[model samples]
Target: MIADAATRAVAADLERQSAHWVAAATTFLDAEEFASEAAWRSVETFVGLPLRRHLKVIVEELIDIGRATIALTRAARRDALALPEAMAAVQKLRRRYTQVETTLDFFGDAVSSRTSPQLRAALQALDALAGASIAPVLTRAGLAPIPVLTYVDKGMGASILRADIRLWAPGSINPVAAIKIVRHNLYRPTSLFHEAGHQVAAVTGWVPSLQESLGRSLAGDAELRAMWLPWASEIAADVFAFAHTGYASVTALFDVVGDARTLLRWPIGDPHPVGWLRTLLGCAMCRAAFGAGPWDDLEAAVVTGFPLRRADPTVRALLERSRSRMPGIAVACLTAPVPGLGGSPIGAAVDPARVSPAALAELDRTAGAALWTSPHWRRTEGIRIVALAGLREAEQPDKASAWIARAREWMTATPLAA
Candidate 1:
């Protein structure tokens, strides 16, 4: 009779703790940030319809977890055997809590940084670019409502993540695409295009399609397929970037890596090809897009550090072969019609010829002085476009700093349309 009393007391304490947590979770869910009408409308207006739905799904999942916790506690009380079984169920609930917490933490970080005007303006610019430029391309590729959010990070390296993977819920509504970038390196955020290309592959199943294409193309050559298969995604991304930015992407990539010493020693089986080869692929795409001229000069400059005379024979032979085929393969991947998109390639739908070099240069030259005066320029140029061109002319630190200031001013004043 004493032992039975002890078990009941323990069960009561367990129920109390679970109840407290349920209240806490409910309070969090009810906070104005997620639950307020203003918050929902603002998110829908600025973030998009897709993301509003995504946020609702996340909130529902979190609330459901809380309700499940309460239900589990009641079940424990009703069943006498629950004391032993309770630990396993509690452990499972704890894991679910952890998953929800991680997602919220990431969202919190993005929200916190928006308090800075410069950061907020930058994010708005990215969103504007997404709606105006990137979204249409993705929609043509047949993956509508792929919402992208831009956030600042400590690392110099820019990164992208599919929120579906982050949340461990595949095929979730309004799937999130996160682009984390270095705050100061605003000039070459063409990495945004590269990362978006990664998303395109993920969302549209382009990577598998490319893999199958490669398998068919190289059917008899198993060794070549093994080497090429691992590098396919990276190649696709590079091609995609090249398609958008043209030669500007090539120069931006070189600036990001800074030197060619890293390229000389790259071996087979790596995820990325040698840096020189990457630049060469970009050069090839540029040539294909805009007929051959000066690209040969650019390619020669890219290989200056590891000249053919000094290359390891294996590296040299691999380059000689990839030089001929990789370009064609990349161009085909970019230009080939996406299956359901009315016989249009995602690249053609993007019509990146619109990103003109002369216009961008003019926009950079007139930046702070005349940008707001001319409504035509204001409507056309985006942060990534003008920044890339601005950095070309304002390579000096002081000049770049001034340009960034102007960019902030331009971005802050321009309101994104609802």
Candidate 2:
């Protein structure tokens, strides 16, 4: 009789715990906990129907897990196995509940960012830029581009949580490429292309191919090959950005990674190239594509500021050897044909020459003042205008404020896709 009474108590406890988690999962199923209806409407307006449906699908899946947990609890009770079996079932449900909460929190932050009008507009524009930067390469490579979501966060560098990857929820796949753009660099966001490059590299297998190519290209120097092989992913992304945005991407990269003290501070197994080497590689890319430009001056400035004497003897030797080979590395990145790109070089898909100093100047001269004000041009060529603005800001620091204002205006004006 005592054992029977204990079984009844365990069944009741399972029932109560199941009810609590079901309610918890259901709370975010409608997203009301994360945003008000008006705010949600604003998100819907900017993110479009497909992304909204994806979010809904994720939520519904969470709720369905809750339902299944409840069914398991009831079945345990019916089988009179409440003490051990039902208790284990409820514990498993708790673990799943935690995962569901984590998934909601990850997406909820994105949804919450859309509530504020200023941020909403900025993110919407970033979404367009991200799409513009990545679509041509993906389409040319015969892969479909996924939806992109941009949100502002406090950081020096931007990052991406790529779509279709497994999420915290056991069976759930991320439905969008969520790119976090740093607040300070929103107006001159060449980093967006870098993060998008990561997504492109992942989907198209550019990184592994580039890694193999780098191995072959640097085979003559065992040390150089070993050092560069590890940096293929980052180098691939940098190549992607430089291919699409030219010197603007290079200059923006300099802005982010140019501190002299940290220039040679490479941690073991870090995917990023040593900062000084990375910036020089950017200059090499410009030299290769456009020939004799501001990047040469920039490279001189970086080399002068961060001399090899400051580095440790071992590091200095590596830097000295790598300096002469930077141009070759850039060429390898640009000219190599990748299987992911269907035997086409990255440069062929998104040509750097299109955004060269001369080309950007020509675009500006042809568009005149209408480049900033025309709705049609802003919609179609907004990404190139951003590159132009970055170039102008780098070339004419005195007029940076005006260039930034114009870039911000168009970015806010551009519409998100439906």
User: Which predicted model would earn the best lDDT?
Assistant: 2
The TM-score obtained by model 1 is 0.78
The TM-score leader among the candidates is 2
| Candidate 1 ranges beyond 4 A from true positions | 1-3, 30-60, 74-79, 138-143, 163-166, 169-174, 212-222, 258-261, 265-270, 292-297, 307-316, 324-330, 356-376, 381-384, 387-409, 416-418
TM-score of 2: 0.93
Report the C-alpha lDDT of model 1 over 257-289, residue by residue, as the tens digit: 545456655675677767766777777766666
* Candidate 2 structure lDDT: 0.80
Question: Candidate 2 — which residues are off by over 4 angstroms?
Answer: 1-3, 42-48, 74-80, 414-418
For residues 1-418, what per-residue lDDT tens digits would candidate 2 score against the true structure?
1235556666777878888987877776677676556555654333445656665676677667667767766666566643566677678778877877787677677767775666677777788778888888888888876788787788778888998898887887887888888877988988999999999889888887888777777778998888888999899889988877889999899888877768877778889999999999999999999999999999999999888888888778778888988778888888877677787788877889989999999999999988987877767777788889999988888998988887787667645342
The clash count for each model shown is 0, 0
- Model 1: which residue pairs collide? none
